[model samples]
Target: MTKKNIILVVVAFLLLSVVASGCSKKDSTDAEVPAEQQVFEETAEDPDIAEEPVEIITGAPLEEPLAEPEVDEIEEEEPASEGSKAPEEQSTSLGDQPVPQEAPVQITELPVESQSAEPEKPSGPSIQLIKTNGETFYMSLDDMKDRSELHFSGSFYWLNSFGSTGHTDFKGVKLWTLLEAMEIVDSSSSRVKVIASDGYSMDFDISQIKRMDYIDETNQDVKLPIIIAWEENGEAYDPSEGAPFKLVVGQKEPGDINKPQWVSNIEKIIVE
Candidate 1:
């Protein structure tokens, strides 16, 4: 070979060696890194990657503080009440409201009697019956007790139809006793009048409840065995049930033409 040709061949051999060495180094470096690690490294260096620098503490480090849960903030509102009236022209907030005042009752001079009069009977229950004659009695309910003053009087159950034959025991004071006490001047007519609460009236004949002439020669018990009941079935008499006073008369015998005649609200007793 010529000297010039040999020199050119040597130069090409050195250039080829240099390129082969560089390729070998690159291959070794690529083989050392895993595909996943290579991708992570590239993304970490990229500007668009969502990465934030974390501060690292050296030595005996402190524990990371626990993050607090976020909560929504709420605002308090005041109540709008009737007593909190707003000023006429302005938007008055609750905080700017003025306290209300109560009106004072006016006091005027008046006669002493007018001020202290027994506050009038403001319309309620009042005694319905008026006293006419004989003896007037006022009984207090607050002091009533059992077996208290047995007053009995009655009339025929069917007055018009029975005449004296249809005569029945009525409600009122006992005829014999009342007559005996009133020192009755006359009982010859054998007539008695009983008034009821509903303004009902009935006439009673003494002959129907005639003096019982049984075993006892005098026969005082049978003659005046009448009852003035204030109650029935262990309870006070209802206003509609003829209570406060009721008269029940029982004759000596069941067939004695006197059974049961209920008369209530006895206003007066006339022995004629």
Candidate 2:
């Protein structure tokens, strides 16, 4: 063939081929797009793929909690019962504690001078007389005695007329009598505690004294000589036997020399 005729034939054949291929491509694209969209909708709406209902579990039972018990408010009690008196709240003091109360006391008269002797002082060394109120008086026995030489040397006697060693008379003034003679008074419940220089002490109740009882019981023999003596055996009291002054209680048994009680030192007489 000639070169121009061959070229026209090839160009026609290429254009027909391109037109057929475009038609086939358009049909294929439309079919594939519809199938893909349907598949996607089915995947989205499928019940099998949806989330299942969850089974929840709580450890405790599901029953509702019991309501809190109702609180009954307490009402004030009635003032008094039908025929009874109202209750009274009584106060009490502690049983163990003691309440102080006024106590009773016995009183005695002050020492008043019943009789006054001479103005002469004690012939011996001065001695101190201590009073209950703590006052001290410096005086000799003479200054404080109502009778002369009642407390002097050789004033005491162990009467040996019976010649029996145990049956002798001791002449002296009664202790209470001497106390009364000195204007020393005491109450009914009083006691005279005589202390010695060596710290020995003896207590004599006025009520128990034989002479005091003798005077009170019989109301007689006011002259019975029971004395606080200064001498023994015609000599001044030995310092060992409470020199200077000692108490000699009269014999309740007459002529009983063994009954001549000799006590000494005469430190103090506490009357209570």
Candidate 3:
């Protein structure tokens, strides 16, 4: 044969061998990859296919969660019914003595001014009445008697808010008598309010009179004597001197013996 014809034959054989190799590979793949495996691979490659996630639990069935202990529910208490009886008040007794019930006190307001009508202007030194026992009395020096010409003569000083009166002597009508004349007693549901003509006033406890310091004169230590003094230094109190009448307490002093409980220009005293 000619060399060109030989070369052409060799090239043809090489092409045929390549074609045979491809056919053999196809047949082997079809036989080895079953239809199921081929379908699975196709489905895995498809974008529309969704695969469920698998959880890898490597432990024994989790010990069944321990049962929770039962808890007792607390019940709420109901309010007392309207018809239920109220508990009786407890009382204390001393020895075998019977316990006493507290006495009812009559209601009263202080400064007694509110309990009465407007007062008439005083033509002279006067005392306006404020009675807790439903009684009233108005009086001037003419109507009041000096039950005691209380003489506070000594080196006694009168300390007051404005200024101090040096050791001086004071003469005045006894206040206890005045209170007695008005029927004030410890049991009365009232306190004493001394009001000045100019509206200045102070309260005096009626119970103070029962105190030894007030009843015992030697008790110079006694709560200083309180008074409705019309005179000081033997002279009547002129307007310049807290005139007409002035309510004062204390006999001597030093230490917060401060400002006398003196409400000057005495006009009225109310018991309330």
Best by TM-score: 3
**Candidates arranged by TM-score, highest first:** 3, 2, 1
Error of 3 at 235 (Å): 0.3
RMSD of each: 20.3, 25.2, 23.4
In TM-score terms, candidate 3 sits at 0.44
Off by over 4 Å in 2: 1-139, 144-146, 149-174, 209-225, 238-242, 253-261
lDDT of 3: 0.61
Question: Mind giving the per-residue lDDT tens digits that candidate 3 earns over 42-144?
Answer: 6678756526433445333557888999998878868768787443443445565555567779976677656665447467656776677646566676454
lDDT by residue (1-272, candidate 1, tens digit) is: 99999999999999999999999999999988876566667767886762754343434456899989888777666766778866555555588875555567998989887663322321321112222334333333232232235354323222222544443343434445544443442434456665665776666676643443311112334444544445554455555543366655544443443433656655444544
Compared with the true structure, what per-residue lDDT tens digits does model 2 show for residues 104-161?
6978765668443334434463334444444344444444344554442222224344
Quote model 1's TM-score: 0.31
Q: Can you give the TM-score per candidate against the true fold?
A: 0.31, 0.36, 0.44
lDDT of each: 0.50, 0.51, 0.61
